[model samples]
Target: MFKSIRWRVTTLYLILIIAALLMFSLTLKGFLEDYFITQLEDNILKETRLVRSLLKDEIVSNKRVKKIDRLVDEYSNEAEARITIIGSEGKVLGDSEQDPLKMENHLQRHEVQQSIKTGVGKSTRYSETLKINMKYLALPVKHSGNIVGVVRLALPLTQVKEALADIFSRVINAGLIAIIISLILGLSLTKRITKPIERMTEVAGEMAQGHLDQRLMVTSDDELGRLSYVFNNMADKLKNKINEISDEKNKIEAVLSSMGDGVIAVDNIGKIILFNPSAENFFEVKEEEIIGKYSLEVTRSHKLDQVVMESLEKGEEVSEEIEILYPEERIIRVKATSIKDQDEQIQGVVVVLRDITELRHLEQVRTEFVGNVSHELRTPLTSIKGYVETLLANDNPDSAIYKRFLNVVKDEADRLEQLIIDLLDLSKIESGISGKGYEAINLNQVIEDVLTIVMPKVSDKELNLKIDVPAELAMISGDESQIKRLYINLIDNAVKYTPNCGEVKVKVYEDDEKIWTEISDTGIGIPSEDLPRIFERFYRVDKARSRNLGGTGLGLSIVKHIIEQHNGMIDVESEVEKGTKFIFYFPKVK
Candidate 1:
């Protein structure tokens, strides 16, 4: 009950009313007691002085105490109080309320002792003879400048207490009535005051639950009503601001999801706050699984974490290329920049990652291609130049020496010519300049054209040739000349690599949608590691032997380009010194 505002306010009001009643009752009670006692003290003091003068001569003359007691009783009856006569020897000579002989000595009495010392004294205490609370006043009786006896008067406080009790009873009754009336009125007022507050609390709760349309009712023009007005305005503004923020958040999410680059955002503490879809693809982790984790944990790249930290701490942009080895070795270009607020304080860091693995591989391939071309051209030109110089220097040379030098120069010139032709063919294939003439061609016819060209090499090697061209093989769509060249490279390689009496086999068949060819050679095979880059231009497994065999090293690269142009795939399976097999597939003409 106390948790609600109504109960709490009513309880507080009741407590205040009770406290005020108690304070007023106590203050009035104390004031009346002090005023009555003070007035009694003054009236009794005057009566004491009058009775002192009345018996002064009798007490000084040493008259019998019985006679003095008679005079004291008469004075007490007139004053309506107890009177005591004490001799100068500290002996009680007469008492109006008791026998003088039976009473204790009055010398030790507070008022009597004081009066003996200072002429007048007053005190209030319980009187044993009267069995009531009494106020005592004393004065000295004197004769011829000597103290004779003390005349004292005592007033009973029974009437004073009765008067105060009547006043207390009346005040308490009035106070109780005031308290009950105030409590009833205060409870009603508090309920009214807190009703609007409770409504505000309900509206606030509704807003917390995403019901921003809830509003408080303004029932009055008091402070609470004005407060309700302000609250309604605040709710309107809050709902609008929240809607705007939600729209902006959705827009940002759309942009991030569509981005090709991986983006990660982190707070200044280096925890992952945002991970986009591209980042999920790059790291192979789900966004929900990795959010709130550290950046290093998600990317598994300490270098990226360092760049993010550096950007966060220094509030600067940092760009770096980091390598991630898990899942695969990928080169990622990470660009980290601090996100700052309008006050220019760093709030977080945003790191954008672009997968540059393919780009880096292309760059390396280009560099090697240029280098290999330069070397290839340089070797043949240097040999031809040396041979020509020898011919020029030998002015008186024999015919045989001139002939040998000229033939050597001619062979190098032929090598240079073939190299140039291969280079041109490869350039055309890569640039999509070749293979534009598409037609339905028979696979066996193209392979026959290729085998006819390589017949001499096969015959020279005296190798056994195996041909398994299925007569019913389906026709495929491609450039006929390019297909012939593709077969020529494979068959020529097989013929060149096979030992004397070794076998070169060619097989052609068809699958559901493709015409398949398998070329297997029982000759020296490629190593396992070099299989990936075997199709790259100018890449030679056995460079010296290949050059010696009159091979241009561009054959396989050209073959790969031709197969791609025909919308086909080529695969190689090779084991060193055992055999090598080339399988290629081209889509059948629909």
Candidate 2:
């Protein structure tokens, strides 16, 4: 309830009024007190001066002290106060209420001392003689222009204190009435002023809840009424603006949803403000989770965040490719563009992210394929040209030399032909141009056929080739020729890479829903870092050694493609010096 503006304004007025009253009361009270005391002091000083005139002649003579006493006693009643006469030697020569001889010397009195020094003195203090609060005034009796005696008068302050108390009582009563009246009128005026504001507040709250039609009523032509008029106008404009903004928002949302590339936008301080549905997969989190998070927290890639930060700080566009390892390993190409206002101030950064993992892998494979093909074909071509040119330059040549050169040229031609065949076969398998070949093929039969073809090479290396074939394994859906090529590549790779007398093992088995194959070789083995790209086209662990072994370098890549076509999965494990293993599984045919 205290949070309301009405109560707040009312409380402020109450506090101000109370403060003014307190200050005014204190000031008036102090003025009255000083006025009362000053008037009393002046009246007492005048009486003392009158009494001084009577005693001037009697002060210097001891014989006249009685006369002085008689005179003061008579005037004391008239003045309505006690009176005293003091000699020059500080002796109390006469007193109105007490015997002159019984009274103490007046020398130590503050008022008497002041009168002797300055001709007039006044004081108010508790008096022991009368046992009451008293005001004292003293005057020097000037005779022959010399001070001979001081006449002092004392007055009780009971009446003065009573008058001040009465004045204070009257002021307090009046102040109470004023406070009550002011509270009643002030509250009414405050409510009257705040009523229009309250109506406008209600309308604004309704507008917040999407009821923009709500408006204030203009009750008068005063400031609050005019404010109401402006408020209604603002409500109308706000309603129209909200409609337009909603339409724009819907369009933006539609565009972001349909986009294939992921989009993320952050404010100038790097808190995310916009995250599209497409971006959820890239970060492996829903848009709601990371909408207000930093880019590094969502992408977990510092390189990608650097692009965003650079775009924000420099107000320029930045692009980078970064790798993410969650949900799967992938390469993301991100482009961060600075969002700006009309004045060209950076407001935030918006980033478009494209998943380029496959694209990059494909490009790398294509580049390697082109280089490998050129090297393979160019070497043989250059040799053939060189040999033919030599035979032509020598008008006559030894037959054996010519035949040996011809044989070397033929061997080069064969190598070039083999590389071309492998390349074409891989392309056809990947492109699906020759149509998919689906048939029920036994895994055991395929392995046996591949072993027969690779057995000769296995024997040449003196490697021990072992096979564990289930006599009747499950058949899988695939092409017979493709499956044969897949096994031949796996087995040949195992045999070729194995050192002399190294062990090569092959196993074929089946579970309820699929058939599985395992091929492991105790060869030189592959490095752990090279296992991921081992199935990429033309990727070789040792290029010179692969060429020497007559490897076209497309065998493992082709094997992977054939397996994928058959709806299967393959995995590899390897150590640098121990061995390598290739395990694969194919879905069973219904």
Candidate 3:
């Protein structure tokens, strides 16, 4: 119960009120008691002075001192108090409440002793003569500047005690009434103050629980009411700000989810705070499983860990391309940046990873293409130069030798021209400049035309050629010239790779969704390991044989690009010396 604010406030209020009432009661009681004691002492002192005047001459002799008892009794009756008188010889000459003859020596009395020394004295004590608690006052009776005796007066404190008791009763009664009223008022005020505060506390609790819509009601213009107003306004602002933050957070989440590159965020302690879907896929782990785990434990890549640690240590961005072998082998380009606050204090690290395997492969292909082009161009030029130089050195005007050398130069020139044409065609196809639009072309007719053109080469080699294409095969959507070039390259390659008298066959067919073409040749087949890379530009399985047959080594590569442009797939099957078959599949036009 004490833990409750309302109870505590009420208790505090009660305590303060009780304390004030107690202090006021005590002070007033003390003041009244003092006032009564002072008035009583004053009345006794006046009586004492009156008695001294009455006995001024009588106290000059022992005969007059004998009447001291009578005078004291008279004054004691009038004052309603006990009275005493003492003579010069330290004897009790008279006492209103005791026999003077039987009384003890009076000079030893504290009041009388004090009076002898200072002319007037007062004391309060339990008096032996009066047999009661009394207030005593004494004065020196003087005669012509000579001290004759001491006159002492005392009052029993019975009336003073009764008066003080009366005052105490009234004070206690009034104090009880005041305390009751104070308690009532304190509880009422405490309730009024604490009710709104309690409500605010409840609302604050709700806000802490993420219910920002809770608000306090303002019912007055008092400080508490104004505080409620401010609290409600603050809640409104908080709700709006939280909503804005949530929306922004959702936007960021969406962006991260859809990103092609992997994104990871770690806290200052190097624990994973955010792992996006791309990052999950890149690391082959679920984000939910790895959150709050250390980055090193999650990634298991020392290079990535080092990058993030370095960025955090240096308070700057660090980036590198590192390969990952776990989950899968991949070449990834990672960029790590240190996250910092407005104070320029390092907070965490953010890493972005881009898979660059395909890019690296393309770079390698480009390098190989440059070298192959140099070698291919150099070969024909070297042959032509040697033959020309041979002719020049002979110098004897031998017509037959000159004709043979010129024929050699012309064939080399023609081969070089074909190589340049193939290169140009490949560049155009790869750059999307060629076959930009598709037209319906009959595959059967394209093949027939290509076979007719290459039939002479087939005849020269005495190779048996067969064609098996459906005349009613579905037309495919592609450039007519590109389709013709595609068929011509496949047939030419098959004829060139085949030895003399080897058999070459072409078959074309159509299904419900696709058109297919297969070119089979009994040729020196591609090795099994080279099938994957057989279509790469300037890659020759038998380089010397390809060169002797006037092959530019770009024919298969051109065929591949043309087929890809037409949204077709081409595959090759081969055995070392048995045979090779090239298959093409094209989407059938509806």
Candidate 4:
């Protein structure tokens, strides 16, 4: 059976209460008994003293024995006593309640012998004549300086016994009442101590049942109160710690669930503790089947296990991109990190797998593109260098042909310089290290200035330039020079690439959230497949024609970075050989 705190406390309280009550009852009983006996003895001694005083003269003259006996007999009945007169030899001479003549020698009686030997004695004894317990007191009678006889008196102690019995009854009744009161008080006190503890027990039990928000209330500063205080503190701390852990767990869960990559967590013992949706999908396993199982068994990826173990042994983060071979022979990039504690101990490992198959393909395309750009730029550069070297070897350095060759060298030099500068600018932008000074500027003025600077190029290409900007065009926040550079790069490319009589148009508009601009040109368009990589550094579609037209593949890349620095986005739409359009969104000025 289960015994609760209240019951145990009540039982203990009752035990202690009973023990005390018994002791008090026993002590009262002994004291009352002694009191009763002492009172009886005192009464007996007082009677003997009074009677002996009355017999003093009679005893001294040695006369009136019968008269004295008669007198004793009369008063003894009133006194409620037994009276006896003894001679100096301790022999009974007269008795008030017994026949004096028939009485045996009284010398052996304790009271008579004591009076004879030492002048007085008192005792309690059983009386044969009365057949009851009685108290006896004796006093010596002195005559003419000689002890003549002793007058002894005895009284029945029945009244004293009755009075003591009455007291015992009262004491017993009082003790019973006191015990009852003590029991009530003890139970009440026990309840006080145990009630809170009992509540704590219940709350703790609830906590064990997964109600982690359980708490305790404090009531006093006694031991019980101290216990309660401690209990409440413990509960509060536990609740806070659990809440903290729960919140962190929730945050981690949110991140893992929403991520585009797969995440898996394993404990130090190589057992899987956490696996997100992506991981489950990637591994083709359910979370229920994988959790609490060995990572090797669940993931079947030895590369991941080896990485985790290495990170644990080194007590550091270990990263390795490995292909996880699935049941279908599909591969993925797994990036693993060791989970560490505040003490720098490796507690577990987390692996994030990113599917980069498309990115890998793009990388291959970029490599081929760079090679093509190299070949395209080198052909023109090599031709221009060969023509200039040939012209330099001639004797006539100021002829018309020489002038034409110098012009060609100058054009090629400009083209090469533009290409180098564009590449350098793209590198700076992509690396997030653009050194252009930044400040707020009127976006309209920047647009006007770039258009004016590029008008000559527009005329040279016989292209029509259209500007449709409102007077209230939103002010832009960026480096004014970089903004100009950004516009020039885009406009120059449009004019240079567009066919004669083609239209180069620019438009600006605003919505509640942002200001946007679009630059559309009837120029050579890019293929849909290469549209995504157009903003990549050193990427060009028509590489040979772009080099001949003084094009640097970095123009679009720099534009991307400038927009990014202004916290904007750029999107492009193009049709192969039909037209190209670039859209940029920027935050409106405050």
Candidate 5:
């Protein structure tokens, strides 16, 4: 409770008020007691004087002791006091409230001795005879210029105490009233002072909770009001600064979230502090699960950990291509850089991972393509060169020898021309330069046309070409030439791979949503591993056989590209030595 400013203020106020009231009560009570005692003493002294005056002449004239005693008692009763008359010999000659014979000597009495020396004396003390506290006054009575006796009077202090009690009660009551009033006023003043401070405190708490718009109300022009104004101004500046920071932070987050490259940030202690969405997807872990965990624990990639550590230790950027196998097998190019502060101190490490699997695959394909093209051209050119050289060397050679060499040259030349054409076609399709001149093409008609073109080769092989196409199949959206090429590639590949007398089947049909086609061949079926890559350009399952059969090895690759250009899907199923089936689906026209 004392932590509260208002409570402390009110408590201090109450303490001061109570202290002042207590001091005032003590001082006032003392002053009143002294005054009442003095007045009572004075009244006792006056009554003593009267008793002495009444007895002075009588004592000088030797009046009866009994008479003096009666007179003293009369004066004492009238004054409501005790009176004593002592002779010059310090003998109590007469007394009221006590017999003179039983009384002690008066000369040694404090008041009597003082009165003898100073003519009058007064004292306050407990009286043995009265058995209570009393005020005493002593005075000298003289006659014929000689001291005859001392007259003393005493009064109990009970009345003075009663009067002081009454005054004390009144003072206490008034003090209590004043204190109550002060308490109320103090509470009001404290609340007024502290209410604004309390409000500012509350607003500051809200601001801490991210409610930056919370503000204080300045209701006065006092110190607290000025403080409120300052606090509000500070809050405004803070809010704007926070907003600016938040905007910048949001922009950074947006860039990170939208990035295709995975980004992970670790602190100086090697704990993961940030993990973007791409990083989560790349690592196959949730950000919440891995945040604040050690980088090595989450990724479990030695290369990734080494990259980050090397960057942090060397305060330089490190990059490497690393393969991850957990989520999926992918080649990722990672660039790790050490983050620094203005002081150029290494604060953490930031790692960016770009997936380069496709790029790497493309690079390998290009290398193989160059090698294949060189080999293919070399063989044909070598043949043509050999044939022409033989003809030139054979002077007066037989016509039959010349004709056979020329024929061999022509065949090689034709193969070279066909390989060049296939290369150009595959290049155009892969580069997305195959122009879109689409039309509604009949699937059955395209199949029939492709069959007619390959019928001679099928007949030479004696393969059973079975056609199961629906005569009235739905029309599909495609370029007519590309569709015909797609059919020709499928049927031609089947006939080339199948041995003599093998069965080749072509089927075309339609479902509610798509046109479907399947080509099956009883050929040397592709292996499971090779099936995935059979559609790559220049890839051949049986290289020698493919070349001998006049295949350029770009047929299946072209077929795939054509299907994709028409937004169709193609899949292949094969079993070694059993058969292979190529199935394709194209969306049907509404």
Candidate 6:
């Protein structure tokens, strides 16, 4: 429904041209009509003077007078006029187109009366002789310096009226042609002027609709063309800016998707605007299903939702941890932060989720392990210090108690040495420092070597040993020393924790793809909650008993690291005072 400017301009131009042409044609027609009327009057006065002279020069006897009269009559007929001569008594004489005897009194006529008094006169009036409207010119005839008669010429103005009418007709025709031509030309000019502008307008409209690449084409150097140039430049700049923003957005998306932690972004309206691939995997939801939905509805994480709302309300950044429970009961840690713009206003909130449940357990184990190790090492260290001080103070080198004190010192020293060795092994494994010669090794041989070293301890405890290893078990590929160290730690733990007459069993087997080993003990079994964290360095369930037993608390920690280096898995299950089971699954050598 938008009206084009071209039509509006064309309409205005046509109006102006028609008005000017009409005025000019009317004025010209008026001037031509006036000129023609004036010329006719002058010719009439001249002819009348000649007739008067001819009448005065020879009174009715002269042939020349008749010829003059015939000439006047011929002139009247040719000029389409009537000529008349009036006597001084106001009687008509020598009247053309009328008999002189029947003519009315002419002395009182407007032109005739004026001619008698002023010698010449002219008037336009209805003529009684011709019975039509006429232009009358009169002149007084003079003889011997006195007026003898008046000559009057009345010309019917029909021919002049017709001529003026013809001129007006031509003016009207010309005016009509001029108006028509002006309209045609005006339309063409308007088209040329407005077409390019219209194109620019269309481009602008498209750009407003988010087509930033739209541009105008310049076709001239006029104002419209200059405007087009500016518009095209503006469009180009807008396109570039939009592309830059798109590129930056793509980069941000790539980073978010590539991250190890899941990322989710929410707008001020609490709708999820960005949900990366990691977030989908971490939350066990699809990006399409989550994006554009309310964050609370999608994540069901009230902690994150409240944090985002509070940050938005305060116009500040906020950080917090949110826990999301999976359908399988696995927990994930989501660290959320509110995004802010340069003005320190909250734009949105970003939540990054990491699977830290295992790490949390490990951290807890490390704390417990440190506490147990500190207690275990301090006991021996205190005993050694007290015994050494007593030996140094007493100068009785041969006292019977001196031997007992030295024996006590030796036992504590031995405990301390074992603690130091265990700590060193745990440290090396954690630092991924397996000594040289990493190769494929037989699981059964490794288990046997550990059993041989712990056989003395097992026999001293009167424990029952059971081995259920198969001869055809597949070899596990890893560092030999590390694997042997792994078995030694497992067997030592079993022998240390098991009571006398308790069962200690070792088993080696193979599934289709993996080689597995399990060591179990019938001892003070670990609780289910504590089973998940038993492998952490220096961890002990019973601090007092573990220290009395001289456990360095790093046995299971070293075992866990060695299994990891071998690309294997370790799992433990226990029931308090019933039993404990440890399983190691390693990739079988091809």
Clashes of each: 0, 0, 0, 0, 0, 2
TM-score of decoy 1: 0.63
lDDT of 6 by residue, 1-590 (tens): 22778878887788788778777867877787779888997888777766666565532322343444565577677656687766667765566676666767878888877887777788888866568889989887766686767777887889888988887888789878887888889879988888888787788889889888777778789898898898888888888998899999999988887888878888877889888897787667998877789977876767767876886677655665456654434356655566778897777877667777778778876787677778778889999999999899888766778899999999899989988888887778778786785787877777778788999999999999999989877777888988888888788888888989999999887889998788899998998888777776666799778877877777787888888887888988788888888988989888
- TM agreement with the true structure for every prediction: 0.63, 0.52, 0.68, 0.49, 0.92, 0.62
Runs with alpha carbons beyond 4 Å of true place in candidate 1: 13-196, 211-225, 254-269, 275-357, 386-414, 431-445, 448-463, 474-481, 527-533, 564-568, 575-578, 587-590
Better of 1 and 4 by TM-score: 1
lDDT of 3 by residue, 1-590 (tens): 88877778777877887788788878877898789889988988898898888776767774654587888788789877666777777787777887888888877878888988887889999966557898988999877787778877778888888988887788789878877887788778878998999899899999999988898889999999999999999999999999999999999999999999999999888999999998898888999899999988988888889998999899888989999887788899999999999999999999999999889999998899999999999999999999988887886958987898899999999999999999999999888886447788877678778878998999999999998977687778988898888888989999988999999999888788998889999999999999998898888888988888899989999999999988899999999888999998999888
Q: After superposition, how far is residue 555 of candidate 6 from its true place, in Å?
A: 1.0
Residues 329-360 of candidate 2 have per-residue lDDT tens digits of: 88988899999999999999999999998899
Candidate 2 regions exceeding 4 Å error are 1-207, 210-244, 258-272, 277-366, 386-403, 451-466, 497-504, 521-533, 541-545, 573-580
Predicted candidate 5 versus true structure: per-residue lDDT over 1-590, tens digit per residue: 88989989998999999998898888988898888887887777777777777788866655477887888788877888888888887877778898887878888888988998899988889987879998889998877678778888888889988888888889889988988898899989999998888888899899999999998888889898899999989998998999999999999999999999999999998999999999998878999989999988988888889999999999999999998776688899999999999999999999999999999988998899899899988998998999899889888989988888888898889989999999998888777775566788887678778888999999999999999987688788878887888888898889988989999999877888998888999999999999999988778898888878888888998999989988899999999998899999999877
Which pairs clash (backbone N, Cα, C closer than 3 Å) in model 4?
A: none
What does candidate 1's lDDT look like per residue over 193-268, in tens digits?
Answer: 8888888888999999999999988878999999999999999999999999999999999999999999999997
Better of 2 and 5 by lDDT: 5
Candidate 6 ranges with C-alpha deviation above 4 Å: 1-27, 47-76, 82-373, 389-405, 457-466, 499-501
Candidates in order have lDDT scores of: 0.90, 0.86, 0.87, 0.80, 0.88, 0.79
Error of 5 at 161 (Å): 1.8
Q: In model 5, which runs have C-alpha deviations exceeding 4 angstroms?
A: 1-3, 57-65, 87-91, 105-108, 116-119, 140-149
* Clash list (residue pairs), candidate 6: 369-538, 538-553
Backbone clashes in model 1: 0
